[model samples]
Target: MGDGRSGGGGANRPAWLQQYDLVGKIGEGTYGLVFLARTSHRKCCIAIKKFKQSKEGDGVSPTAIREIMLLRETCHENVVKLVNVHINHVDMSLYLAFDYAEYDLYEIIRHHREKLSHSINQYTVKSLLWQLLNGLNYLHSNWIIHRDLKPSNILVMGDGEEHGVVKIADFGLARIYQAPLKPLYENGVVVTIWYRAPELLLGAKHYTSAVDMWAVGCIFAELLTLKPLFQGVEAKATPNPFQLDQLDKIFKVLGHPTPEKWPTLVNLPYWQNDQQHIQGHKYDSHGLHNFVTVPQKSPAYDLLSKMLEYDPRKRITAAQALEHEYFRMDPLPGRNALVPSQPGEKIVNYPARPVDTTADFEGTVAVQPSQPVSSGNAASGNIAAASVAPSRSMPRSMHVVGMQRMPNAGISGPSAAAETKRSKYGNAESWLSSTEEALLRKPNGGHTCLFEIA
Candidate 1:
C-alpha cells in the first residue's frame, strides 16, 4: 500500500495491498506497528495494525486473535471498529484495519501541557470523560473488562461525521470476566504502573471492573492537572513482583489503607506479607486537594475521591459516575468533546498527530508518497487531505441497556492455526469460513447527547 516501491522486493505482493495507499506509520507497541493508509477507491483514511508473530513462531499471536474476537462482538460509537482483516500468506502476517483517529487523549493532553501551556477546558474534559465512561459502561455491562485504559488508547476522530467523538481503542489486554474458566489473576500483571489500582498492587487474586475505574480516575486527574496522578518507578523483577514504589506513591497521597477504611485490607496477599514495607509509613491523606485544586465539597473533587478510593468495592461504576453531580453541573457533557459547550467560549485548537513516512509496513525504510495527502488541518504537519467516508451507522437494535451478560464470551477451544496454504486476496470469504467457528461465540450478561452552540 505505498507508491508501489516501498516494502523491498514486491514481485509477489498480495493483491489486497493495492486497495489502499500507505500514508505513514502512526504507532508501534509490543504487539506490532500501526500504519496510516487511505482506501484507493473511497479515499477514506484507516489505521492498519500489523501483528507480530507469536513467540512460538507457529501462527498469529493470541493478542491479535483476542482483540479481533472481542471487537467483533462489540458495536458502539465510542469503541473502535475493526473494519477488515487481511493476511499475507507469504509470511502469515496478520493486519487489522480500523477507522483512522487523528487525535488521542495522550497527544491532546501533551499539546495543552507542553505546547500550549494551559489546562484543558472544563467542558472538554467533562465531555471526554463522559464518552469514555459511556463506552466503558457498555463493555462492563457485556461482561468485558478492559485491563488497560490509558490516555493513548482513548482516540478522538478527526474531520468527519464522527469528528470530535472519542473512540476507545486497544483491546490487546481486554478480557471477558464473567465466570472465566481460569482466575483473572492467571492473566498476570495488567495495566500501566501509573494507572494501576491499589488492589492490583496489593496482589489481589480476585478483582472486578473496579481496576478499570481506578485507571479512569488517574486519567481524569491527569486531564485536569496535566500530569500523572501517580508517577512511580516500576520494578524490573520478573514473575509479577510487588510494585513497592507504586504502592508507596499511592499511600503517600491517599494515606495508608486501614481495616476500617477497607474491610478486606487484611485479606490481600501483600498487606501482611509485605508488612516491613508497609509499617511505619506515615502519609498526609489530605494531599489530594493539593494536586487537584477543586473545592473539597465540589462535585469534581467528590467524584475523583470516589474513583480513587482504596477499596475497589467502594469505587464508582461507570454507570453511576455518568450520573454524578460533576457531569450534571454547568457545561454538561456533550457528544462532541472538541467543541465549546458555552457561548463566547474560545475554542481550543488541538494539533494533529504526527506521521513518520520513513517506515513501511514491514518496518523497512520506504519511499514517501509522491504527493502530500490533503489532511484538512493545517497543523497536521506534512500530512494533508486524508479524507474519509462517513462511518457506517450501527443499528440501535444492537444496543443493550442496563446489566446484561454474554454467556460464552470467554475464549474457549483450541487456538486457530494460521494456514500455510497460499491464497488470493479475493479468497477472504473462504478464509473467514475456515476460522469463524473457532473464533465466534455467544456469551450472556448485560450515553446521552448534548448540543453545542455554534
Candidate 2:
C-alpha cells in the first residue's frame, strides 16, 4: 500500500490516508477540502471529502450529521450517493468517499456558454429540468426538504451517453419537517442568496419545501437564458430586496401581479410599500424585461412561473412541478436514448451509494458529519469537510488544494490491487477489514459513544 506524509504540519495528517495516492484537488469550500484520490487496491475513482478538526476532541459539526444521516437513508437515481466514511484515530479527521462524477452543472453551463451560442437546445433543457424535478420529488417524498438547491449542487456523471444521469449533490441544509419540535435555531435561512425564496427573504420563521421550488424557478430561467434569472448587485438591506426594479421588470412581460390576481400579496410579512419607493407605482418598468432578456419561452415557461410564484403557499411542490404540463409536454427519454454507450466504460447505475456497515461498531470512534455554523443557509454547518479522525463526527470544509489520479504501478501488492478492484466495482465489503472493524469497535477508549450504524 502507498503511504507517505503529505503537506507540512505532519501532526494533522491521518495515519491511514498515507496509503492512498493523492490525485489532485477537485473543489474547496469553507468547511473542508475535497480531493480526487485512488487507493492502492483499486483504480476506481472516489471523491474524498476531508473534514477539518476542531479542538473538541475529534468532534464534527451538527449539519454534517444531518447530511450523512439523510444520505444514508435516501438513495435515488436523482440524488448523489455518499458511499462510505473513514475516520483515523491518530489525527482525528474524517473522510467521506463518494462515487466520482464527470463534472458539475455550473461547469457545463459555463463551457456551453463559451463554445456554443448563449442559447441551449430545448432537448437539453428538457432533460435537465426533468432530472432536477425528479430528484426534488424524491427528496420531498421522504419528508426531507433540501433548504439549499442550486445549479452548482446538481452533479452529472458519465460522458455523452443517454444513461449518464444528473444527481443532486449537497444536503448540508436539508432537514426533516416536524411540528412541535425543537427548532434547529431561530431564523435559519438556508438557500443561496440568489436562489433564496422571497418568503425566506422576508425572514419567515417557518418555511417549507417551496423555498426549493423558488430555486428551481431561478435555475430554469438561467438555463433557458444562460443567465441567472434574478442576478443583481448586493444591496445594504438585511432583508435583501433587489436593488433595481427587479420585481417590476419581471411583471411587465409575464403579466402584472395585482392584489386581485395574487390575493396573498398583501399577506407577506415583509411586503414592500410600493408608494414609499422611488417608482411610487406598480410595475411601471416592464414585465417583459425577463422575456426580452432571454429568447422566446418554450412551453416550459408556464410551469416555471408557478414554481416562482410570489406566495410560498401558492408555489408548486416538487411532486406537482414534476407532473406539470411543461415536463409532460416533453418527457425525459431513457438513459440509453439520451447517451449511448461510450468506448471504454459501462453505464453507471442509479442509487450507487454504498450500503451502511451493519457490523456493531458502537465503541469505534468513527468520524461523524458536521453541522453548518451560521444560522442561515450560506454558512457551512460546524463540520469542516477535510479531515480523518476517529472521533470526528462530520466532514469539515477544506481548501481544495489540488488532484491527480495515481498510476497503477504505485500499488505494491496483489492484496492492495484486489482492494482497489473492489472499490472500482462498488463492493462495500472492501471498505473495511476485520482489523479495521476491531478498531472501529473501540472508536474512543471510553466515553459516551456517538458513532452508530445509520
Which candidate comes out best when scored by TM-score? 1
- The residue ranges of model 2 lying beyond 4 angstroms of the native Cα positions read 5-19, 55-58, 88-92, 159-163, 181-187, 235-267, 272-281, 288-298, 330-332, 336-454
TM-score of each: 0.82, 0.66
Query: Model 1 reaches what TM-score against the true structure?
Result: 0.82
lDDT agreement with native, every candidate: 0.74, 0.53
Off by over 4 Å in 1: 6-11, 367-454
The lowest-lDDT stretch of 10 consecutive residues in candidate 1 is 445-454
Of the candidates shown, which would achieve the greatest lDDT relative to the real structure? 1
Q: After superposition, how far is residue 269 of candidate 2 from its true place, in Å?
A: 3.5
